[model samples]
Target: MTAALDVKGLTTRFETRAGHVTAVNDVSFAVQPGRIMGLVGESGSGKSVTGFSILGLIDAPGEVTAGAVLVDGVDLRQLSTEDLRKMRGRKVAMVFQDPMMTLNPVLRVGDQMTMAVRVHQPMSKSDALQHARKALEVVGIPSPAERLKAYPHQLSGGMRQRVAIAMALLHSPSVIIADEATTALDVSIQGQILAEVRELADETGAAIVWITHDLAVVSSLADDICVMYAGRIVERGTAEQVIGGPRHPYTQGLLDSIPARHEPGRKLPQIPGSTPQLSRLPEGCPFQPRCPRATDLCRTEPPLDVRDGQAVLCHHPLEGV
Candidate 1:
């Protein structure tokens, strides 16, 4: 079967006062149906920008300069505005970090959900309403019928996010890009939302791109993981492979920084230096300035290589199995 989503040589750039700034540089990955791909990185690492570009949501001075975002073999970049707009919510949807981005404070929850369903599907108001209610039930919302009459402001943060997720699932889109969708919620709530998302993907065979800075979250939810640094994906592999035995120095630093994984009484390891601004990015490896294992060769750009099913871009990758 065709991959649910495939992104090839994806590059997003912005025309800023300082000149062209690349936010997503040649990032590529694929998510199979019923699978979740986790995009992990630090702030300014361009993980979120990659997702936005794939959804054709990049605006203003920023645009996807090169790449093919294929949803079930149909290239999204090649579609016209009208066609892309139609395809967006029907074949692919995005769950944003903030639920307010998806919900209208002035509208009732039922209206927002049903409207989304009707916009993508040919159905009567009654049918759409029924679908909306069922979606709410599917996402574990309590009193689904009563909640539909409430406005977004009336619901708690977690509830609003659940409603937003329900809206995304309204049409059963084949692909969903979740950009830090659970970051703002409490731990329990975040887990609940993830479980719901996982269930939805399994039930509908929808491919999901889960973008976040939390390695722990990715470790639990993703079948595969991609680690980004300074706009480029520095490492990609199965969740177990990347999380258990990261090859790139940056990836190792990330794994070390996790508080829970640190040895008792030991200070958590942090990758030194901040992420370089896009306008002033270093000449060679962006992570070289902070990498503990950096050498003279690391000062030159390293090619991304595939070894043992893991893709790594580093001059001196970790040796041994």
Candidate 2:
């Protein structure tokens, strides 16, 4: 079966004053309908850039130089700007980290959502409003009819985010790229949203790419996990495989370093050093400088070693599974 969203060898770069910085290099992944693929990594790992690149949201200095971002077998990179713009909301939707990115402070929540679908389809205002109300209800928003008339600022943070998600669902798009959308919410609210989002995908049959730095969240919310380092995917496998037995050193470090993994009175283990700057990344593996498994072979780039369907970019992959 064809994937709902397929990204192949996606390379996005920015020309900075220092030099060219590749934010996403030859990254590849596929997400089928009703499936959620977690793009997990630290800040500046290029996960957010990957999401923006997929939606044609990259700005002037940043550009997607190579590879394809396909939505239901249609390559978005091959489309014209106007065509891409048209595809964004109807065929693909993005739930940005900040609710304000999706909500216009000046516009009433109802009006904004109504405009979202109306632009994609020639629907009457009343029909659009009805559609918006139904979407809000679908996302578990209460008193949807009254919520629509209020401005974004009138709603609480969680409410605003729910409104944003409801807007994304308004079009029933084939794909949704949620770039750290729940990171800012309180823990309880975040969990509520995550559960709701998973249910939403199941109900709508839409593929979702959830980009986040929180592994604990992904371990529970995602079916598959792609651990990114310095713009490249260093590990990819089923969520349980990656979380239970991480082959890549970077993946291991991430799991080991999370606070929840530490026992009482024990400090959370931290990965040595920090993520490398994209412009000055080492010639070999980007994580080699910080990897404990580095060797002479690591000075050169490591091929993605495939074992039992799991892939790890490391000269010496970890053992035990």
Candidate 3:
């Protein structure tokens, strides 16, 4: 089967008055149908930029300067504006972190969802609304029929996000890019959404790119994970492999820094130093400043090393299985 999404050598950069900032550098990953791939990273780690670049949504000073975002083997960058617009909701959809980004404050939920359907298919309002209601059901929303008449502000945050997710699923797009769509929700709500999303992807055979900074969430919700640091993926592997036996120092640091990993009273481990400014990144690994195992060899950028179904980018990765 063709991959649902394939991003190859993606490099997104921003040209600012100060200097050029590489937001996503040489990132490559593929999500097969029915799989969830977590794009995990810290703030300014370029995970979100990767999402925007894949959707051809970057604008103005920022651009996808390299690589291809392929949907079922077709490059999105090659599509014309009209074609791209048509392909967006029909082939690939984005679930933004903010539900408001997807919702129209003035529009009724039913109207917004029905419009999403009609935008890609010629369907009557009644038929489209049926689909919308079913979508809400799929996302576990209760009182779906009555809620359809409500406006965005009438619902709680979790309800609004579910509506956004329902809208994304209304088209059964081959791929969905969820950029921290559940981060703002409480832990229970976030877990519910994550579980529902993973189940939906499996049941519908839709690939999902779940971008967030929470390694714990990804560990439980994703099949595979790519750890990003300073605009580049420092590690990639099966969720269990990466989380349980992380090879790259940065990945290990991320795992260690999780609050749950430490004893209740002990200090939580954290990567030292703030995220570096992309425009002024050192000549070596972006995580070198905070990496405990950095060596002189790290002064030069390390190539992504692929071994035994894992990719590690570091001069001195952890050894011993």
Residue 238, model 1, lDDT: 93
> Which whole-number lDDT from 0 to 100 does residue 285 have in model 2?
78
Off by over 4 Å in 1: none
lDDT of each: 0.90, 0.90, 0.90
Report the C-alpha displacement of residue 227, candidate 2, in angstroms.
0.6
State in Å the error of residue 241, model 2.
Answer: 0.9
Looking at model 2, residue 100 earns an lDDT score of 97
TM-score of every candidate: 0.97, 0.97, 0.97
RMSD of every candidate to native, in Å, equals 1.3, 1.2, 1.3
lDDT of 1: 0.90
Query: Considering summed lDDT, which 10 consecutive residues are worst modelled in model 3?
Result: 299-308
Model 2 bad stretches (over 4 Å): 302-308
